[model samples]
Target: MSQITRIKGSHRAASLVIAGSAVTTSGLVATAEDAVDIRAQTRSVLSQAEALFSRAGLRKSDITRVQIWLADMADFPAMNEIYDAWVDPEHAPVRACVGAALANKHYLIEIQVYGYQPD
Candidate 1:
């Protein structure tokens, strides 16, 4: 059986979880002061995901899937602008985006990703 490793979060949720080669991150939102803007929020979320990926021994190219949640669909293009710049175009992951009411009113976007941490 593969060992499971959890990192950085409260009892309610783990920021990152790794089970064998499969790595997953909890839904991540922007924590920056400019987080109210979709562009800034997306950048912050992706940065957070990147940090967790590094901790799990993964890279942008190792990402297999991406899930994004937006407070408003209108922000999609703005979020994509940042996302497109950050993602590994050579190994772009399967992705899905949808509009949802976020936990925080100030949050404009949230992102979660699944990746492979090869042995």
Candidate 2:
């Protein structure tokens, strides 16, 4: 069996977990400064996800799935605009976006990423 590795952050939960060839990240939120703008919040969240992927030795292309949560449905289009530009069209991962209340009112968006590490 492959050992599970966890990368922890200052928060109570692990930031990223790696088991076998799979890598998963905890929900990533936008910075306080970007929280007011959907586009900026989306960009901030994705950038944080990218940083986590890099730590796991994975890239955006390696992502297999993505889960996104928006504080308001009205922000969907704005979020997609940034997401569309950041994701590789040829390697786009399966994704789901939905409107829901975030942990913090200031967080306009949150993103979770899942990917596979190549052998």
Candidate 3:
């Protein structure tokens, strides 16, 4: 049977949680210091996602879905460049990218992932 574990300080609507060996959700937010570039923001988010998954005992190949929110659509391609290099090609996750004003104006992107771990 699958178990669900929720991480504290995450969004109630889109929080980080682990669901047994079948699924896990990444953290809902990303923050950064002022004067950072979009690429740096992307890297930070990816790093956080990796750490979150690692802590959950999950791997990149386990990812099944991803939703990315961008402050500007123009950044999608750049974000994809980084994202593509981040995940395992053989196990690419289904993804959606859209432009939306983020929590803080300085943040260029925020990503949420849904993944499955082995039994």
**Using Cα atoms with residue i matched to residue i, what is each candidate's TM-score against the true structure?**
0.95, 0.95, 0.82
Please provide, for model 3 over 11-115, each residue's C-alpha lDDT reduced to its tens digit, 9 standing for 90 to 100.
445346766765555534556452276677777787777777787777787789989999989988888888888878898899888899887777788888888
- Checking candidate 2 for backbone clashes, the offending pairs are none
Error of 3 at 69 (Å): 0.6
lDDT, candidate 3, at 55:
76
C-alpha lDDT of all candidate models, in order:
0.90, 0.90, 0.75
TM-score of 1: 0.95
lDDT per residue as tens, model 2, 70-100 = 8999988888989999999999999999889
- Which parts of model 2 have CA positions greater than 4 angstroms off? none
Q: State in Å the error of residue 60, model 2.
A: 0.8
Tell me how far the alpha carbon of residue 1 in candidate 3 is from the true structure, in angstroms, after superposition: 6.4
Q: Residue by residue across 17-75, what tens digits does model 1's lDDT show?
A: 99888999999988858676888888899999999998876888889999999999998
Model 3 backbone overlap count? 0
Better of 1 and 3 by TM-score: 1
For lDDT, candidate 2 versus 3, the one ahead is 2
